[model samples]
Target: MARELEEVKWEKFKLGDLFRIKSNLQLNKNSFVFSENGEYPYFTRTVFNNGILGNVHYLDEEHKLKGNCLAVGMIAMRFFYMDKDFYAGQFTKRAIPIGFSLNSRLANYFITVLNKKSKIFQSSLVRNFEKVFKNEEVKLPVKNDGSIDFEFMTSFISELEARQISELEAYLVTTGLSDYVLTSEEEKFLEIFRENEVKWKKFKIGDLFEVNSYKKRFDANKVNILEEGHPYVVRTALNNGIRGYLKEDEEFLNEGNTISFGQDTATMFYQEKSYFTGDKIKIIKSKYKEFNKLNSHFFVSAMSKSFSTFAWGSSSFSISIIENQEIYLPIKNNEINFEFMETLISAIQKEIIKDVVLYTDKKIKATKKVVSNK
Candidate 1:
């Protein structure tokens, strides 16, 4: 049996008319704070990861006295989204519904729709807040009885979420094993080959590769669906650290190139495909034959972890340090067979692709169920 798409009536509403955008109150560094095991969770802008927080900052009695703080089910919109409530911080624009109970699930759905519609909120920086606010409008669907189907909507989303989490877990396990296999073999070979016939030579990264940065910028409107052979890399893709070419604006980067994050506080995993984005990302072309032997995952793991240490503790350190950093390599004419290593890596990559496809299929099936119910 099929549930027919019902003709649902929707009311047009300006978000500003029904919601009050609250200004964030800053907490002083000197304020009293509680330990991790505190009485209440301190809410902040970062708490808006899909409208839930696993861990929260804490505030003491005095800090809590400062009024205008939100309670747990309050609808928040950090930025312009359809109706999804997001936790607001000093940086994000917060919204409070005027006369309705905060329906967190409904709000999340609206935000998801808005995100699908535009990419304005993808970046933390607000470039055109005024324009975005003025142009945005939300449509509230009404049931036959003129009331929201809160339970049905929530259940619909919950099913999808549960399915996604399961698929993600499976994907993680398969990829982790694949990575282990690739890294373990690469390490074993390097140790054996390096010791036998070659004297290790140290060289700076800049001496072996041509580092380039793309200067052209594209707006959200200019981006297209990620397809093969298109240039795309952004902060979020780097954050995903998946191996595959991303679909993005054709004008963003030079065709057929590899990129790595250079500036993020968190280490990004390397993927086989290019389509990554981040401010501190490095784009490189290897000038040496050994450069092809440089496994993307191994290199990114080393750089991200090392660079993050420097960024957190030292102000003078920059990714430019890579240009001067020493790397130990085997002598050119030695019996080190890089081609054999590449073949092993390629096999590992194929296994990863198989896992990704399996996970993707599960996700698609789950998505279909949710969409059908809707």
Candidate 2:
């Protein structure tokens, strides 16, 4: 059943009236030791990755901004809902609710309002929050008797979250991850190979794939980065490493389906679209007509694990080493078991998709219940 939204009464209020503006402690960049595995998150003017520049273990509770507060970027009009107690970097400010307990979801609502209002004040290096935003009028949901509707705000966010989760689940489905899983019969059948009862022949990497020694054709001058153009740009990373796009180019490097590797990092990526490779990228495609995109992906996954074995950790990653390498694939009666490869990928994808879909479905249902009850 569709949840019907109650009539919301919006009341205008100045920014200062609702929340007490507070600036974060000025900690120098060097004072904080950055690490991916750090205890606490350190936030900066970084608009990307939700303002988390890096993680740190700064144990100053007095200086740290507690969870469920809004962090506003000083220079840029960037805002994020700091859900965890975070160490603030230089040039950052936060909002403390005047009298109410600010939930992170509710803080997200306020950040949305603040982001739209503050966009006009952006681009300037210096920012006077008191002058620009302190008295800025904004609307908030209110009840029948002229009180803030916290429940409605929570429900609104919850409904949106449900929809977003469904969208993500749909996306996961499109990735072919939700296609199929291994049945009991299929799993038992593969136990023979797992037990090493079936002998599989090893093949040299050079025999399967050959690197396309194409010169880099990406020129920033001729091919401008577009909002939506041919995905003529790809890097060595697995996903979303497309720096820019190109409309037209003389040497548009496009291999229908191939594996790309970073010459220095040994970082591998599978490319399906026609895209021009960035600097230090080595492209390799299947030498045999039997192999396709699915096979390339499985090979890339296998090769990614063996990156540490290569001598490229000290020096530049040699394509020659990868070319001369050997990989083992399941073989039946002197032929590659392409069906087994297909089933293997499908089973793996299904397992991942199953977990994600289960979690997301539960969240959506829970959020929907909250919405419906409200």
CA lDDT scores, all candidates in order: 0.48, 0.72
Candidate 2 lDDT for residue 352 = 61
User: lDDT (0-100) at residue 294 of candidate 2?
Assistant: 66
Candidate 1 local lDDT, 206-311, one digit each (tens): 7765666644544435444344553345445343543234455445654233544433443334334445343555555666455443355444544454454454
Q: Give the number of the best model, judged by lDDT.
A: 2
For 86-185, candidate 2 gives per-residue lDDT tens digits of 8888888888888888776787788888898766657443456655666688888888888888877776776687778778778867776554467774
Runs with alpha carbons beyond 4 Å of true place in candidate 2? 1-98, 101-104, 110-156, 179-181, 189-200, 220-222, 238-241, 311-319, 367-374
Which number leads on TM-score? 2
**Inter-residue clash pairs, candidate 2:** none
Cα RMSD, each candidate: 10.7, 7.6
Quote the positional error of residue 341 for candidate 2 in Å: 2.1
